[model samples]
Target: MSGSRIDFRKAKFLISAPDIAHLDEHLPGDVGVEIAFAGRSNAGKSSALNQLTEQKGLARTSKTPGRTQLINVFELDEHRRLVDLPGYGFAKVPLTLKKKWQQALGQYLQERSCLSGVVVLMDIRHPLKDLDMQMIEWAVESDIPVLALLTKADKLAQSARMKMVNEVRKHLADFGDAVKVEPFSSLKGIGKSKVLGILDEWCKPQWLMDTLEQAEEE
Candidate 1:
């Protein structure tokens, strides 16, 4: 592989798993690269994914928060996958169900060996909630790169948006190169290219690059 750009528009729904056990059973062994998308309920996670893949209904947008109750996987290629994790916090679901969902989310984050990157979407108007911070910290601690996407950037004025972006950058500056923050709007298509570029970088792991190089040599 030449570390080529991935055509995210080609993303297709692969499978949905309710828990890590099912995920392991379905995918088995955690062999390839997986970039996960995580955010709170109604944080525009589905919208961001739809925009990224250019599929209007790929991730199933819903007016109801927490409709994405399962671990939805989308395949870009055999060696690469995009995971749509269930939304956390602010979902009006039952207490027991909420706890189960949270458990699954935590398990996936802590145990998934193939998770190469995480895109944590947050509302620009209300960025960096406690859950969001925890997600970022977990990814950073796990040595997985994160794209802290401030979603719905169009809701704010240009000045405000830029200011919030800077403030978030400063707040997360301690993480250094492990995290990258950006303003994104699914409606306006803002920052889509930049986000995709970052994802393209994540898709080309050193192991995959080495394999591609060896294949070329053969």
Candidate 2:
């Protein structure tokens, strides 16, 4: 399929509920690249994923802060898995719950060798919080590639959105090697192409790359 014609289809939920400790078990053992998404509560992580895949209600999107208590995993073409980590930095949530989710998310991020990259979502209106910075630091320390999505871009004016993206990029300059920041809007479809392009990089199965290339020349 041509890249521009890309639309989410034939996508089904493989696993709806996944706990922190059992995330590895829920994942297929065949060993392929899996991209994970992380963000603070109500950061539009789920909404963005649902929009990307064009699957409404695919991942749970909640209005209440700290609603996602577990890591949710969604399958893409049965070859790639999009992992959704629980949110953080919602001080209104209980301390015990926060710590538990944090440890689970931290373990997954730090130990998952199959994790190809992490898509960290931040609200365009309020892009970088202290907790968001910490997550970037963790990805950097682990040498994991991160793509920052300044979600809810439609909520901001066009000029303001550009300014916010630049500001966020500057803010993340210290971790340049580990992350790339871009503005995204699930509502306006802004940055959809960019998100899909980044995902394409992860979709290329290295094991099949040579074989596909040879076939293409035929």
Best by lDDT: 1
Q: After superposition, how far is residue 139 of candidate 1 from its true place, in Å?
A: 0.8
lDDT of each: 0.92, 0.78
Give me the overall lDDT of model 1.
Answer: 0.92
lDDT per residue as tens, model 2, 52-134: 98887888777786776787777765456788888887668778877887888888787777787889899989877888888
Model 1 over residues 1-218: C-alpha lDDT tens digits?
55558999999998899988998887847877999999999899999999989999998998998976899999998889999998999556789999999999999999989999999999999999999999999899999999999999999999999999999999999999999999999999999999999999999998988987888799
Superposed by TM-score, candidate 2 places the C-alpha of residue 127 at a distance from the truth, in angstroms, of: 1.6
Which parts of model 1 are misplaced by more than 4 Å? Answer: none
TM-score of candidate 2 on Cα atoms, chains taken together: 0.86
Q: Candidate 1: deviation at residue 72, Å?
A: 0.3
